[model samples]
Target chain A: MAATTEFELVSPGRLLLSEPVEMVVVPGTDGDFGALPQHAPMLSTVRPGVINIYKGGRVARRLFVAGGFAEVTQERCTVLADEAIDLAEITPAEVQQRLQAADDQVKEARNPEEKAAADRARGLAQALAEAASAAAHAHA
Target chain B: MASLKDLRARISSVKSTRKITSAMKMVAASRLRRAQEAAEAARPYAQRMERMLSNLAASVAGQAGAPPLLAGTGADKVHLLVVMTANRGLCGGFNSSIVRAARHRVLELRAQGKTVKLLCVGRKGRDVLKREFADDIIGTFEEQGSKGITYTEADRVAQDILRRFEAGEFDTCTLVYNRFRSAISQIVTLQQVVPFLPSPAGNDNQGAHGGHEAEAHALYEYEPSEEAILADLLPKCVGIQVYRGLLENYASEQGARMTAMDNATRNAGEMIKKLTLTYNRTRQAQITKELIEIISGAEAL
Candidate 1:
């Protein structure tokens, strides 16, 4: 049997997930990185994307995180996400709504800071929409 | 000396007040439970964030180019007090205690020849402080956690503070709020968020076991370099600190409200008891007077 590492997904609201997993893939700001047992300790920022959790050599669950930080140790990987949601629970309509709102925000932003924030939101919303569609295709 | 009808009215009024207070107590009890759970659930994230940041801060400490958030602006001329209190007034002494502590800090800082700027998080704090320190108050936030304390709200406040810091607004920032001890007791706590100060307990333990932990930390590899991570994490640390303060203050508010309402309910019960007793006594006296008058009238006939 392969070694399992403890994975914890924490949001500010609560601890979303805490369990032993065979592997986990995090979408870091630099790139996607996978953490397995005995991985070297590393800290990186997480971008808004899907985090794939593996169990028994198969992707067991997928979660969407807005953005935050990830700290990887040899035995455990803790992800402090600003927001996290189970991809399975997201509806297409919700994604569309978010995209629309983000688009409107981008158009209505009056200052540089507001524009930057709105751009980030739009990027996140776009990513979420794509992820939702991809998940839909995978399920189909 | 009161009429029987007046005593009856007073007794009923007290009874209704008791009912309202008891209801408020129950509501606060339930809300307190939820707030306590939320605070508990957020502990792990905040703790881990602190641990990681402290590790990074330890590595980056004393560096010439350290982030200003960690190393501070190298001057204590200006201070910002982020006073967190409840918006509502039902809580007994919760808001007042926090405001009092903040006011004391403001006075102390001013006495030391430091400029003090106030950033109030809740309306109650702003309302109280505005009377005396109206000119010093820079910003006021209200109803940020009306539904429940959220990270986004804290992040907004943190971003505002960061912007102010970037503009050279304040040298030091302190967060003042109530630390929930129990449903009956909450202690007013003042925590320095800017120029990040590690908790004294963590500092002492780290000093005692510095050697091995330092070795362990040295093994961890940084992705985009230590400085970048520290810069990113420092602002987050501020946000998390504010988030924690808000959460703790919220739980304390609920706990305080629960206790206050419990006391109010008890006081109302006592008043109702007294009023009911007076009502009974007055009715009995009125009946006795009527009986004596009827008996005397019969004797005259």
Candidate 2:
């Protein structure tokens, strides 16, 4: 049996990634987890974070998923992102602005629901910012 | 018989018209190709979203406390028509088809003792409908020259719709647009957005992946409770659905226009050929008669 599994990441604008990857780590609603081939079927709401794609006994690539859902079959994983960016295309500075905007919305949010959504946006933005900064100095 | 100058003018005019239609056809064809690709790419995301929504919505079908969007307003006294069309025109009957469908439906609703309101999302639709249904139009929105319509724009439209719903402005809502069927054929579509209809029963009990649809069904305990979940999800659903509908309509318009222009161009070419043939025959006859007159005059002298 082959040790690797296939994963596809897509959005309305573009299909970001599709290939055989060793492992795919995603941020599940309950918590973050890593997935491999032949995994049990699962569906989860994914927040913004770096999706670490492991291949060839090493971490091969990283993707920043803004907000989306993940569907896992027995042998493949599909991530439908509302918005996603290649890690290389993103910058810490860009996400910092997003974080600031989200924070401002938090202050202006009138009700609890609005505030909660705004809060989620802020958390996701901050997470993206942190990931961008950490990976900024890591050449390739 | 028509004068020689008249025929010459007619020929030139037809030629110019042919050129314009031909150019338009080329432009439409290029735009249509792009729109078609985009629409094709969007299919997967749309289907997946619907599948997820259906799964989630099915779970709460018989259960109480479903959101208003899924649960519906529980009445049909008032109706809102969300008319979607192109912001621009010159695509022959593309814009008119949607407006025509909306007009027919609105008239039917009025006759049935129902209240109908118009909420036009595109400039072309508003321009057409306002001539007669001026009072019925509540709001008009057009995002011309934008890179493309955004979810944020969709959200804004949904927010407005939701506000009206809260005030009980509409009990049943319908969306009017054109469905992209093919390059040659585009079908005008009218979809009911509210008053959730229970899907056909007994089609699939098996999950998408599993052998049994029943096994694939997901069970979730709502975080804040089903009522709250519905309240939140329903509004978002409205936005997403509208956003999708807008994109679909946009693509459809371009396709329809492209096809229509192509036909026009071919028709113009055929007409120009016919006109040129007539012009040539008339010129030959005039020349022949003049030569006979000159020969007879010389013989008499």
Candidate 3:
């Protein structure tokens, strides 16, 4: 049996998942990093992307996180996501609609602060769209 | 004495009032359970966030380049009071108690020669505080989390506050809200959120395991330096604090409403009982008077 690290995925609304996993890859602000058992403690900001959870030597599940933070310790890896969605559950149409709304927001933004927020939203939407397409391809 | 018809009307009115109050009580009870569950579910994230923040804060404390959100503006002249209350009015003294506490703080700050500004989160607080502090009110947010309190709603408020802070609007920020204790009791709490006061060591949930956690924290590495992460986390901390306050306020509102409706229902039941007794007594007296009249008429015959 492979050594597993406890993985916890939490959102502001609820605790989404808590269990032992062989490996987990998080999309950090700098880059994607995988945490395995006995990993050194590290803290980083999560980017808007997909997090892949590995179990039994294969990818078991994928979750899309908008943005938040992640903390990795030796025994556990916890990701506090601002928003999370199952990659399998999101449809292409929904992703497209979100991207369109984000684009509109970006165009209508008046000030730098508004523009920055809109840009962040646009980035998240774009990421979601990419993740959705990738998931569809993988499934097909 | 009232007529039998009036007594009957009064009894029926009381009966209807009882029914309405009982219905409200049931509704509030169900809502309270849901609100409680929401609050409970959000605890772990909040706790972990706070724990990690405090750990990072401890490492960065007393540094020259600490973020203002954690280091503060180095002054306490101006204060921002974020009063959180329910939008509706039927929740007993829940809103008033929070408002009263805020008002008291305002007066105290005034006495201390400190400038106070009001940022009300709910409609009821604004309505109550407007009479005296109309000029002091910077903003009022109504219909927030009308369906249920969500993080996005809280983030919006936090962003507004953060913007104001960036513009040098206030030096300190305090949140006044009702902390849910139980279904019948809600304690008015005044929590200072700004300047990021870490929770006391003794109050940590990881009391027994603190040594182990602290050892791990000492050896932990930061991705973009502690200062950068702290800068990012502080604003999020404000959002999380607001989220926590909103959630607690919501649960407290439901609990308070449940208790208040329960009391109203009981009072109405008592009123109905008294009205029924009065109606019966009045009917019997009228029957006796009619009987006496009939007996007198028969004797005359």
Which candidate ranks first by DockQ, i.e. highest? 3
- Deviation of model 3 at B202, angstroms: 12
Q: Is candidate 1 or candidate 3 better by DockQ?
A: 3
Query: Candidate 3, residues A1-140: lDDT per residue as tens digits?
Result: 89999899998889899999999999998899999999998889888999999999998999999988898888889999999999988888898999999999999999998899999999999999999899888888
Which residue pairs overlap in candidate 1's backbone?
none
- Who is ahead in lDDT, 1 or 2? 1
Instruction: State the lDDT of candidate 1 residue by residue for B205-299, as single tens digits.
Output: 24433543533465667776787778788898899888888888899999999999999999988888888788888888889999999999999
- For the second chain, the TM-scores of the candidates in order are 0.93, 0.87, 0.94
CA deviation > 4 Å runs, candidate 1: B199-216
Worst 10-residue lDDT window, candidate 3 chain A: A87-96
Q: How accurate is candidate 3 locally (lDDT)?
A: 0.88
The ten-residue window of minimal lDDT in model 3 chain B covers B199-208
Question: What's the DockQ for every one of the candidates?
Answer: 0.61, 0.26, 0.66
Docking class of 2: acceptable
Q: Write the per-residue lDDT of candidate 2 for residues A57-124, one digit (tens) a residue.
A: 77777788876777665667777787777777876678778989999999999999889889988888
